[model samples]
Target: MGRVAVTGGTGTLGRTAVCALRAAGHDVVVMSRRTAPGLATADLLTGAGVEAAFTGADVVLHLATSRGTADRWQTQTVVDAVRETGGTARVVYTSIVGVDKVPSSYYRTKLRCEDLLHASGLRCAVVRVTQFHEFLGDFFASQRFSPVLLTPDVPVQPVHVRDAAAALVRVVSDDAVGRLPDVAGPQVLDGRTAARAYRDARGWHRPVLPVRLPGRAFRAYGAGHLCSPDAAVVDGVTFSGWLREQLGSAALT
Candidate 1:
């Protein structure tokens, strides 16, 4: 195991990845904007102190993200720091599944980051992942005060961040040279079905309405581009199981 610097190390997936890497016996350093006892302050937005943080790192986990195309600049900063430091660290970038398919500005930014790494002339790997379990959970929670739960009239294969983090560890540990297979959940659930299940779990009895929003991105989502056909479903907790674990099994349908 070698030194690994994780950008956005305090984030949801970042925290899990850092733990997995450390448990795998790799030396890990967390890089964030705020300075902490064990974290190296490296703001990817401004490229501040990134070189020093990436120095001597065997692999750099690029987990930092931003809204819209700001991710493009952030990824460029990481690449530039790696080059400026004269380090040959393999960068493991965490990307979203269907970055190439979705027409959303955020997905475009993700694809741009991928392109930047491929063109940066550095050893890098890209792993696309499906929506996290928390993502769906948050959606239901957002509708807590609503009279009806508005679910998207589309299917989604959501994965647990813990499993995604574990896959990320494997990518970093192995010969990560290029784009790897997509990671996804074990099962795919429709909008209304998933919403009903989520409603039961939260003990919030409400009418679940599956609505279709008009947008290119929403249409892309409805087309199942987010759920890649070649995705490797990880053997981990499912969405319903995760809900039970979080909200208890008593409130389930």
Candidate 2:
């Protein structure tokens, strides 16, 4: 098995992918900016240590991402580093579903990164997935302290992080396929429903107020820009199942 290097290995999705790759008998090296015990140190923001992190890697999983427009710069740095290597290894990337159609700043930057990969000259595969279940929790939990939880009334299909990680592992193990099929959760629910499910699972009685925000981003979200029901390859686990797992784990601690 060839060595696989994963950037952003400390993030939730990254960590899951790292474990999946390792379980599949691949030599996995974690690349991140922070100095973690088993991670290769590299900062995509400043373009530092990227070359060393990618050295001798037969498969580079570009899992690193940034907030807002800064993602463009970070992705550019990685593309530059890969170009310098002159190696023909496969570079698998994780991207959000509907990034090309979504009218959000983060999605736009992700689309730009996808473009960079297409033009980077190296073998690459872009695995686009819907929002993770944990991301939905974070979205609703942002205003937990407030009397009412304000959540957008847009549809969301959240996949489990481990399911997405397994799909990525399949991509890395097979031949490089550009722009693979979209991955999404088995169930599709609006933000309010998702938030309520999460709250109920935690035994929190906080009232969820669904607010309709008027904007291109929210409009796109309402129009189902983030959902690809027809083309999506649904995972087995549902959002409720994921919530139960979270609850079970919390009970142990």
Candidate 3:
């Protein structure tokens, strides 16, 4: 079994990855800002708590994200820590698809992180994945009282969190390292469809209003720049299937 460390292990994706790794019989360490049993406390933004977390790790799965501009620093710090640790063989970084094509600050930061990982001289695999199904729910929940879902007129290939976790585990277990093909869900669905699915799943009686975002990011999404026509890896769960599993019969619209 490999000694594996997962940053942001408390997060949805990270926690799933940790569970998968442990199930696969790897010695797993979860690094997060908060303290949990068998978890190493680390704050990537301040770089205050990473050294101990990274020590003696054979594989580092970087799944942490920072708020705003701090993301760049956090990613660099993680890369540097892995390099300093010496025994680290593979650095698996989770990035968003179409980071280069999207003209958003978050995507730009993600691109920068990818660049840092590639230039770190470490054996790295940058796995770009489509948005998660849960991300849409979170987005809708961000606003209160309006009871209306607002979304850009763009297509998205949303993958389940479990599928993403499985893919990450596969990469960590294999010797192949580099920019793997983009990972996406099996089917293509637009934002409105995703919102409607969420609404149905939650039994939410809200109107979903589609808004066209005026930017390169929106255009890229509309043009399918964020999706891979030749996706290297495809997850099994469809968006509707995942929603039904999560919400049961309530997911039917």
How many angstroms is residue 25 displaced in model 1 relative to the true structure, after the best TM-score fit? 0.6
TM-score of 2: 0.92
lDDT of 1 by residue, 1-253 (tens): 8889999899989999999999999999899899779889888888888999999998999998889667899999999999987849999999998899889888888999999998889999999999998998898898889999999998888898888998888888887688888889887778888898888887786899999999898998898887864675656778888888898764333
Off by over 4 Å in 1: 250-253
Clashing pairs in model 3? none
Better of 1 and 2 by lDDT: 1
lDDT of 3 by residue, 1-253 (tens): 8888888888889889999999988898899888767878888877777877888778889898866778889888888788777836588889998988888899999999999888888888899998887876678767546768787677888788888888888888887788987788777778788778777776778898988877667777799876765663444687788778876855533
Q: Count of backbone clashes for each model?
A: 0, 0, 0
TM-scores of the models, in the given order? 0.96, 0.92, 0.90
Candidates 1 and 3 compared: the better one by lDDT is 1
Query: How would you order the candidates by lDDT, starting with the best?
Result: 1, 2, 3
Better candidate by lDDT, 2 or 3? 2
- Provide the RMSD of all predictions against the true structure, rounded to 1 decimal: 1.4, 3.0, 2.2
lDDT of 3 at 243: 78
